[model samples]
Target: MAIRIKGYKWEFNLIESPEINAWCMPGGKVAVYTGILKITKDDAGLATVMGHEIAHAIAQHSAERASQMTVAQVGGGLAGAAVGNKSESTQAIVNQLYGIGAQGLYVLPNSRKQELEADKMGLSFMAMAGYNPQNAVGFWQRMAAASEGAQKPPVFLSTHPTDESRIAQNPRDLPEAMKYYKK
Candidate 1:
C-alpha cells in the first residue's frame, strides 16, 4: 500500500456483513473487509478493489456527495414551497421525491463518469504500487456475481453505476495503466 500511495497503509478490522468491501478516508485511513479476501484471492485483485476505493477518497467523492446533498435539500425546500401543498398526502409525495433525489445525488453508488474516473485513477495507483493492472477485471466480475440476488433498497441501485458496466470498462483502461505496471 505504501508503495502505491505515498502516505497510505493497510489496516485490518471486523465488519458486520459478509460483503467484500474496502475504503480509504482522508489522511490515508484504510480498512479492508476480511470477506473481500475471498473475492480478491490475490494481491493484484485485492489491489484493484483497494485502489478503486482509495481513488474515491482521493477524488473526495464523499465531500462532493455531501455538497450535492446540501444543495438538493435547499432546492427541495424551495420546490416544496412552490408546490404550495402542506397536506399529508402532498408532504408524503415530497418526502418520497426528496428521498429519490437524495439517493441520486449522494447516496447512490456513483455515476458512470465517477466509476470510470475511479478505475483510471485506481489502476494508476495500483500500478505505481507495483500491482498488475489486469487484476481489475476479475475483481469487478466477482463483485457483480456477489451482488446477484441480494436484496437491495430500491433507491440504492438506482444511483450507482452497475457492476456489470464497470467490469466492462476496467479492461479498456488497462493500456493506460500498463504504462505504469512494474513489469
Candidate 2:
C-alpha cells in the first residue's frame, strides 16, 4: 500500500475529447477525457477513473508491454534464423506466422493480466489517495452500462477483460483496498 510517487514528474491533464476514456502513459503522463466526466459526476467518481489509469503508469504497464513485444520480436527472429537455410519466402512466412501466434499466445494474455492487476491496484490506490474504493464499483458499473450493446471481440482475442469480468472483480478487490482507507 506504500506507493512512492514523489520522484516522477507527473503530468495530469483534462483532454477535450468526447470519448469516455482515460489513459496513463509511461513516465507519469496522464489524461482524462471530458466525456467521461458525465459518468464521474464528483470527486470520488473522478478519483475512481484517475486512480485506475494512474495504477497503469505506476505499475509500468507500458514498459512491460513494450518489453513483451520486444521479446516476441526476438522470438520471431530466432524462429526465422532457425530456418536460415530455407528460401527468403519461407523465412518471411515463418516470421510473419510466428508474430501472429506470439501475439495471441503471449502479448494479449499478458495485456489482460495487466488490466486486472491495474484494477486491483487502482482500488488500493484510490483508497490510499483518500477516496473510498467502494466508489470504483459504481464507476465501473456505469462504464459497463455505458458500453452496453457495443460489439466487442471475443474475450480470448481481446486485450482487456470484458465489462462483466471487471465489474465482478471490483467487489473482490474492495476488501483489500479498504485496508488502505482511513476514516
Give TM-scores for every candidate, taking all chains together and pairing residue i with residue i: 0.78, 0.91
Best by TM-score: 2
lDDT of 1 by residue, 1-183 (tens): 444345645453445566677766655566787888888889988889778877877776667767777877787778678666578788779878877766665556555466678888899889999998888888888878888998755545564566777887888898999999977
Model 2: residues >4 Å from true position, as ranges?
1-6
Question: What's the lDDT for all of these models?
Answer: 0.75, 0.89
What's model 2's overall lDDT?
0.89
Give a tens-digit lDDT track for model 2, residues 28-129: 888999999998888988998888888998888998999999999889878988999999999888888898799888999999999999999988888998
lDDT of 1 at 101: 68
Model 1: colliding residue pairs = 4-129
TM-score of 2: 0.91
Compute the lDDT of residue 4 as modeled in candidate 2. 49
**Can you list the residue pairs that collide in candidate 2?**
none
